[model samples]
Target: MNITYNQFLISDDKSLLQLDAICGFLGRSYWADRWSRETIAKSIENSLCYGIYDGGKQIGFARVVTDYATMYWLCDVYVDETYRGTGIGKKLIESITSSDELGGLSGILGTKDAHGLYEQYGFVRIPDRFMRKFPG
Candidate 1:
């Protein structure tokens, strides 16, 4: 699906995704700063990816890791530094949370600084109920 907002667009078309731009977003993020380009590429290949565009240039991105019926992990969400505060981030989250394919499944994400943003979409701080384990 493609959603238009003003002159920008949010699309679930993986074919429209630009690898170089996505790498730039993830590479600069504190959370995913350690992620290699290959890792980012492989992750996008296996997950449901979304790209936000200004005309043909990719300006934002997000991807959902999911089991379709059980739950989804929203990760690697980023809007270019140049596009911040334009309601693009909020629109991106809205698009994801309201998507027909992911609407009914529980969603979780890890954000050191975006708590306020996600909370507007019903995500609460559940540090007590969340846990993680490193893969071997």
Candidate 2:
């Protein structure tokens, strides 16, 4: 899907993504601070990616790991620092959650912050119902 908000365009076209831009942003993120460019590329290759752009420059990004049927995990959500507070993050999430590709599927995400933001879109903390096992 392609959407326009003011001068910005959000698209799911993987070919439109800027690898260096995405890795630069995600590498600095608290969650993926240790991620290598190769890892980021591999992740994008395996998941559904959304790219938010201004003119031709990438300004935001998000990805979803899903089966396109039963479940989806939203991750790697980020908007360039300069683009924050302009509602681009919300629009990205809105576009992802509302896409027909994920219709009727359950969505989940983990964030140390931004709970309030996700809550606005019907996400709720499941209170001890989820667990994780990181690679050792």
| Alpha carbon lDDT of each predicted model | 0.95, 0.93
| Residue pair clashes in candidate 1 | none
User: Which portions of model 1 show Cα errors greater than 4 Å?
Assistant: none
> Which pairs clash (backbone N, Cα, C closer than 3 Å) in model 2?
none
Q: Candidate 2, residues 63-94: lDDT per residue as tens digits?
A: 99999889999999999999999998998898
Predicted candidate 1 versus true structure: per-residue lDDT over 1-136, tens digit per residue: 8999989999999999999999999889998888888999999999999999998999999999999998999999999999999999999999999999999999999999999999999998986887889767
TM-score (all chains, Cα) for each model: 0.96, 0.97
Q: How much is 62 displaced in model 1, in angstroms? A: 0.4
TM-score of 2: 0.97
Error of 2 at 45 (Å): 0.3
lDDT of 2 at 93: 90
